[model samples]
Target: MDTWWLLAIPVIFGLGWIARGFDLKELLSESARLPRSYFNGLNFLLNEQPDRAIEAFIEVVKLDPETIELHFALGNLFRRRGEMERAIRLHRNLLERADLPVEFRDQALFALAQDYLRAGLLDRAESAFKSLADTPHADQAAGFLAEVYQLQSEWQLSIDALQRSGADTPAKSRTIAHLYCELAEAAIEHKDLKAARERLAQARAADAALLRIVQIEISIAAAEQAWARIVELADQTLAEHPEFAPQVVEAYIDAAQHVAFSAPGQRPLDTQLRSWFDASPNDALAAVIIKRLEAAGSMSAALEFARVALQRLPRLSQAHALLRLRAAMQGDGDEDLAHITQMMNGMLRSQKRHECRNCGFRAQRFFWQCPGCKQWDTLPYAASPVGP
Candidate 1:
């Protein structure tokens, strides 16, 4: 037998003794009948007949009103079955008894808090959990409080509660970064660029490996028309995480454009564009290079650049760029355009925009958190094939 059963034997005998002293002969007799009903309820539970088992346990509670164990079991069962109302009623009744032991009372309060939490009565749940803050249940209550704060989108409160409970392990730091990112996004929405920048700094401090924070910072700098800052951040990001080169190409182009426009005689845009393209052969980057070449009155050079890129990435976008350049010279032809468009459509059909590597969830747009599994920084950018 388990050591808990050995410990419980003395409590059972004491309850029987107390019942006899109170001249509660019926209660004393009912104590003797407990084993049979308790075993029957266990059998029913093992058989997966939860309704029948709960009925048996309910009868046992009625007969032996002082049996705290039976009440706890029934309350837990109701909660497991999604019967929050019944679980709350049973736990509340146990809490009301003046004669109940302190341990049992604490257990009842914990159970009642769970009931309120499941019912979405967060205020009542918080109050009930607060009462257990000094008890053995404190750690568990604090963890639940963190979860409640997360649901309410109160990231700071959630972080505080998690720290108090010591539940914020190393693996949770990535999640902390995401929370800071969310705050940064909110600040951006409110047009508070300074606060948004501060939050992004905090996010990077929390988890230096978080590439999304760098991306967001670059975007904010671009929005503020801080061309130098944008270029600096984009360069740092690419140097740190080169695999995100494709995604950062557009920002880099925009930053270069801003610089070129700001200082016309400093350095030609083509020089910087050619240098980056030589360093990284990204389709998006190649596209930007072609556009820049065309803008500089060099359509023939742009065609040559597109052809060189096509050798590496035979995607529809590159092919379309080539076709448009050719048509601009030789006049429009539906056959060539139609063929390239069909190939592009075919490539897109096999592509997934984003996928959550943690949970295998696929979606069209990027999500910092997975909606299916609620994990932070789990989604990965998926590459689609280009056609010519």
Candidate 2:
């Protein structure tokens, strides 16, 4: 029986050795399709040694040229790491392969376009995206085209590209309007009033509710010295779009004063100004009133004007207009005037008048479109954008 047990022990160990040999054979066969460098690359990647991993992976790709997935992974890794030249080369090589599947061909083309764009090869990128026009990537390609055209200041091309893109919605109406307005603004800069007018008309057609058209129209009228027309247009537009009340009011006040001061024995525009202030006691309108009162040497009236403004707006352009007004009323003279002038300058310097409601991008001046997000009408009217 002891001898029988010793024989059984040898048989069990032999069976275990045979099983291990079979397992090792299977592992060797499976790993034979992948080079040893592939395992080294994976180990280096696991250790976060990307430079070494890349070198090892390149060795693997060279050893096994049919490693399609490995190529794609490595190519994308290069692109994300800002190695555009390598990404471009790898994707181009993939595209050159006639045996590549249709799906892979399209993916390679898109990746190639991205590589070109990242490298600032805009013309090449444009050509690549144009080739993708009729494919499933058409809409995405169109969006990139819009961005490219806008960046290049090709307003008409940008507008056409946006029209082709599937991103058009009621929400993007102001963006379309701005595209048209940009053309109008360009025309005006080039002294082409007729073309400017036409473009402005198109801008309004894109979004009838835009305040930009009114501002442009006022500017055009100013160029023609049509102060009366400027006032008329400002009033008409302000009636429908009261959100631009501050700007329209300022324009009207300026135009009215220009016409009033140009002619002799003409009544001052104070009546019109006072009437507007009575209807809408905005801080800007009140400020205008105080200026007129101070111009006429009425300190009491100017103090009263500032007091009334403070009731509606506690801080004028986020400055303590009320406290300053009280101090001026207490002091009351050239000292007060100098102090007030300094305060006004401070307010001007501190104020961020326009802000992108979409992206919270603040600006000292107004933008029809946000510089941060490139969206139109996102900059709302506010003297103090970042603060109450």
Q: List model 1 lDDT by residue over 136-242, tens digit each.
A: 89888887786677777898876666667755566567777777788888888888999998888888887878888877887788778888887777666665555
What lDDT score goes with residue 277 in model 1? Answer: 61
TM-scores across all candidates?
A: 0.60, 0.66
Q: Which ranges of candidate 2 are over 4 A from the true structure? A: 1-99, 111-124, 171-173, 258-283, 316-318, 323-353, 385-388
Q: Residue pairs in steric clash, candidate 1?
A: 315-386, 315-387, 316-386, 316-387
Q: Estimate the overall C-alpha local distance difference test score of candidate 2.
A: 0.77
**Worst lDDT 10-window in candidate 2:** 316-325
Residue-level error in angstroms, candidate 1, position 100: 2.8
What lDDT score belongs to each candidate, Candidate 1 first? 0.77, 0.77
**Deviation from native of the Cα of residue 22 in model 2, angstroms:** 29
In the range 79-145, model 2's lDDT, one tens digit per residue, is 8889898989999999999899887888888888878877878889888988889888888787777
Model 2 residue pairs with clashes: none
Can you tell me which runs of candidate 1 are displaced by over 4 Å? 1-34, 40-67, 231-253, 256-364, 381-388
